[model samples]
Target: MSLLEVKNLKKYFATQKAVDDISLSIDKGNIFGLLGPNGAGKTTLIRMITGIFYPDSGEIFFDGKKFDPVNDVGLIGYMPEERGLYKKMKIGEQTLYLAQLKGMSRKDATAKVKDWFVRFGMESWWNKKVEDLSKGMSQKLQFVTTVLHNPKLIILDEPFSGLDPVNSNLIKDEIFRLAANGSTIIFSTHRMEQVEEICNRIALVNKGQKILDGTIKQVKQDFKENLYSIGADSLPDTTGNEPYEVIGKKEQNFIVRIKPNDKPNDVLQYLLQQGVSISSFNEILPSLNDIFIKLVEGTETARQFQNIKN
Candidate 1:
């Protein structure tokens, strides 16, 4: 069953559609990537999903029931891109306060805070004010509080923003650990490589509309370019008059985007037939970045083509 669902979600300003007919779903224990360029309605969608704002036209459901902004609030743990914490308050004190605000009892919050702080080697920070800690350290404290209540769903917007590489990996590892422990995560990020590595499914939104949505692998395959790169030692004068049109050539061999009738086996046989030594053979698969740009640009090309056809 889906842990979260949005249907025809729309949020608009007087003269702008902040989020326009956006819709997608996420299953339990999976990381869903919300991707788009800045000012592309990503933040607006996140706000609606986090219950920070109401949608003008749409429905949000959680666990198969209509989603209520209030009732479902506690069930979600949201860490905004902009970190917020009281800089003058003691670190431990602030964490405990926030945990309790999330509905955990004071006693439970304190105990949880202690366990987490010690595990994170932050036991000595119990009395240090937030202003005394480094940016990464401050983020750690805030992150601990965000998940201390063990929310069923965790929504993170650029969760690694201010951390160093080591600290960032620590947080990434924890994200995967949380999923392994059955926590569903909604990961919103602009880092395409990270999305490729961590996300099981992604929904790419542009200009407040969903342009693509599906499993990462399936989406990549759907956008495959049907091109192959062949690296070889040497070949015949393979040029203009050659049966295959060499579209591009790199250091080792030629890069060819073959016609539909050009079979891989036939290409290989022809290369060998020409006495060209084959060292490496590989097909080019579209990267998430490639797919993203293609989809976004393809929308415009498709519209232009349709206009011409009409």
Candidate 2:
């Protein structure tokens, strides 16, 4: 079931269209990735979703019902890119206060805060002030407070900002655990590798418009260019071009692009006839980063060409 849905969402700042007629849906228990480069209007769209900014035009539905900013806001746990914790407050006290603000009872908030502190190995830092902690420590403390109320929908922007590899894995594991238990997550980051690691579905926006949306596998398949990597002691030489093009080469390895209507077996047979020794051959799949750059650049190039034509 879809936990959140946005239909024809539009947000404008004077003459600037920050979010231009965007629509997306998040299913229950999904770790959906909202991805884009800097200034791609991702932040604007996110603000609208979290009720921090009202859309100039559109409808937002939560769990199949029209979402009301007044009531539905409490159902979301948002960790914005900017830190909002009190620098002067002690970790435990601040955590408890934030939980209470989310409508959790005092007893429930304290118990949950203690449990989370223990899990994060910050039990000893309970009385420590936020200003005294390192950046990574502060990040963990803020994360604990964000999720303490156990909201159904969680939005984490750059959740791994300050942590080293070890601590990053710790939080990654916790995110997986949360999804397993029925929480829907919206993960926003510029890191493509992280998105590939954790997100099942993704939406990519560029220039205030959604340029791509689908499962990771589907996106990769859609962008595949029928390229393959092959290793051989020697390759047949047409220098100019043949049934396949050797687009790249290093030592005995070659990256080949098969021409339209040409079969892989035919290429192999041609190499065999020429007595070329084949070592290894595998299809080359495009990475998410490759696809992202390709789509965004392709859009820009087309826009430039249109401008020139005018």
Candidate 3:
């Protein structure tokens, strides 16, 4: 079942359509990726969902009921791209304060904070102020505070930013654990590779609109160019009657595209007839980054501000 749903959501600014009639649903226990280029209205959409902003029109449903930003906001844990921590505050106190803000009892919040600090090897840093920690360390602390309350919906914007590979994996594992334990996550990041790796389903927003939405596998299939890579000892020159056309070559692999009326099997059969020995045959699906570029390219390099009349 969908844990969160947005229908015909619109949030407009005086000079721009920050979020224009967008709609999507995120299922329970899902790690959903919300992606877009800079100035694509993703932040605006997220703000509305998180209750920092109200929609100009349309509806939001949380856990099967109409959204009440005042009450439901407590169920969401949002870590914005820009870090928000008090530089002068002690780590332990800050974390506990944030948890309580999310409606956790003081005693419960302290217990959870201590557990997370120990788990993240941050036990020694409790009394240290935020400014004293390194960027990566601060990031880990921010993450701990965000999830300290065990929110039902955790929205992490660039959660892995500023962390080393080891630390990145640490947080990644926790994200997976959270979803496995029934927490739904909305992961927003510009790193397409990370999205491809971590998200099972994604929605791509561009210029205040949702241009793409589907599972990773389904989206790849939808945008596939039907290209294939064949690795062999040798490849014969393409004959006019061949079932496929060799489009390119890379390191002993010939990249080919099957003819309109032909299948991969037809290509293999034709290659065998020409005395070719195939070592490997694999279809080449476009990467999410490639698809992202293909769809958003040729549009404005930056979103242009416009005059909104009304």
Candidate 4:
């Protein structure tokens, strides 16, 4: 049920390859995370998908047909990292105008605006001008406009850029609501925790190439390094003698980077045999950030460390 598919996508600017042979798909109703640090070619790929730029060598498919820039363009709602809105216009007036531009009828647009205004508790401010709104408030106004058209596909870049925790959570909830109601979202953000929370599928890109892409769980498992985190009341004194190598030790816990060939339970038994009381024993899986750096540095580092026998 992929709503969007990209194949061998390539984009070159001058002498640089911004997107090289990238291939990925976005399933229906998925919140796919497009992640990369600055200058990683994430924006290049997004621009092509949104029709802002043409791919040098590739094809895009939307809804089982070859993508037609004009028709399928209306089916997508894109919120660029840089917010786009008329600063001098009233919130209610501007929101309705944008919705209408997206093909929403006047009456339906107004009704939906009212519903969102009440939900966001911004009914009182709707009559006010966008220029008078704070940065966070302006973001909400722009966000409302982006989703007002009820497009089947939504691409949000840095959607939570200017909001406080409360507002960030509010927008996050609405994003989940949209997906639940049959919208597919391509969410791009630098916040690993946010991706972990909301994104089902993810693609990590670096240096104009797709370094990795998969389900969140699958990606994490792929970057696995058999490590253990243990909290103990009395840690064994292995100053000179123990099979386990402690990577680090904190207040009440020690982070052990285990040999991949060693079983986790075997490490636990060795600790217990040394009369150490284990309070908590947990595996150390790679975080999205960790995985990103590993991939960009070259996936070979992960391979070398994946099967070490101690």
Candidate 5:
């Protein structure tokens, strides 16, 4: 089931259409990646979803009902790219306060905060102020506060910023745990490799519009170059009538693209008939980073400012 749905959502600023007619559905228990380059309106779309900004046009549905920003806000946990913690406040107190704002009672919030602090090995820093912690430590604290209320939908933008590998893995594990237990996560970041590893479904937005949407595997297949890697000691010279064209070589593997109207079996058969000793064969799919660049390349590196008419 879809936990959140945005239908033809549009949000405009005086000089830019921040989000323009974008639509997407995020299913329950999905780690969905919302990917885009700078000025791509990802932030604007997320703001609308989290009730921080109201769409100028179109509808948003939360759990199948029309989104009520006032009441539904509590059901979402948003950790923006910019940290929102109070510099002067004690970590423990600030966490409890934020939890209460999400509708949790004081007693429950205290217990929950303790549990998370202990889980993240942050028990000692509770009395410390946010200003005193390093960037990575502060990031861990912010993540805890975001999910303290056990919200059904969680939005994390650049959640891994500034963390070392160990801490990054720590938070990554928590994100997976949250999704496994039924939280739907909207993960926005510029790290394509991380997106490929963490997200099952993704939507790519550029210029305030959604340009691609599908499961990671589906998107890869859609953009595959029909190239295959063949593990062989030596390749037979192409006689110009071969079913595949040798594109390149990597170490012991020969990279080839199957000719149109030719199947993998046809290539294999042709190779075998030539007495080529094949060890392994596998198709090579384009990486998300490759696809992302292929789709967004040639576009202006920076979005130009535009005039909007009322």
Candidate 6:
């Protein structure tokens, strides 16, 4: 059974539809990416899932049961994009307070907070006030508080914000560790590389609607343009109109879009027959960033066209 499920969920504020008829299911131990452009329905959808807002229509299921905010509060951890730390509170005290509010006993919260501080190398910062920490340090403290209770499900929105590369890697490794230990995660971010690295599946929403949903591999394959990148000392000019189109070029490098049904081997044979020594050859698979720009821009263009027609 899926760890979380939403069925035709919808939410509206006045005349604006924040989330419209979105449905998604996340299985246990998987990192599911909730992705979209700015002002898209991603935030609204997340709020509904986390019980910060009730859907105007449809239903959500948690652990195979209908979600009841009061009863299911302890089962999930949510870290919003905005920092919620109390500036005047000491790090250790604040973490303990947050954990206890999440239903953990004070004793258990203190012990877990101490262990987390040691793990994150923040033992010395225990007595330091939140206002004294740098942006990155505060981000780390927020992360510790979010996970202190060891909730079965975790939702992180823009978790890497304000984190330096080293600290980002630290959190990335911890995310994997949590997932490996049977925790389900809902990751929301604008960083495509992070999603590509950690998410097994993703759902992209835009303008209050779901535009894309699938495993990362499936989505990429579906968006594949059959482009190939070749690196060599030099590339021969396709003066005779070779079977492939040269889409990009740089000094000693070329990206070609092979025709439908054309094999890479055939392209290689042609290059060899032309006396071209290949230094490198590989398919130019689209990155998540590439796909995101394409889909979002395409949707916007279509919307503009529709408005013109109307």
Task: Compose the digit string of candidate 3's lDDT tens values, residues 68-177.
Answer: 99998889999998777999999899999999999999999999999999999999999999999999999999999989899999999999989999999999999999
* Alpha carbon lDDT at 190, candidate 2: 84
Off by over 4 Å in 5: none
In order, the Cα lDDT scores of the candidates are 0.84, 0.87, 0.94, 0.85, 0.95, 0.89
Off by over 4 Å in 2: 239-242, 269-275, 298-310
TM-score winner between 1 and 2, please give it. 2
Using all chains and alpha carbons, the TM-scores for the candidates as numbered come to: 0.90, 0.91, 0.99, 0.90, 0.98, 0.92
Clashing pairs in 1: none
Predicted candidate 6 versus true structure: per-residue lDDT over 1-310, tens digit per residue: 6999999999877646778799999999999999998878788898888899999999999999999888687788999986579999988888888998899999999899989989999999988999999999999989998888999899999999999999999999999999999999999999999999999999999888899999999999999999988998777776755667788886678989987767888889889988999999988779999999998885553222112110
Mind giving the per-residue lDDT tens digits that candidate 4 earns over 1-117? 899999999987764677878999999999999998776778889889888899989999987899887777778889999766788888899989988877778999999999999
Which prediction has the highest lDDT against the true structure? Answer: 5
Q: What is candidate 6's CA lDDT for residue 294? A: 91
* Candidate 3 lDDT for residue 214: 98
Could you tell me the lDDT of residue 155 within candidate 5?
98
RMSD of each: 4.8, 4.0, 0.7, 6.7, 0.9, 3.4
- Candidate 4: where are CA atoms >4 Å away? 237-243, 297-310
What is the per-residue lDDT of model 1 for residues 190-290, given as tens digits with 9 covering 90 to 100? 88998988899999988779989999989988987667788976556756544455668788867776666767787788888788888887887899998
| Candidate 6 colliding pairs | none
Output the worst ten-in-a-row residue range by lDDT, candidate 1: 301-310
- Which pairs clash inside model 4? none
What C-alpha lDDT, on a 0 to 100 scale, does residue 159 get in candidate 2? 97
Give the candidate number with the greatest TM-score: 3
How high a TM-score does candidate 2 get? Answer: 0.91
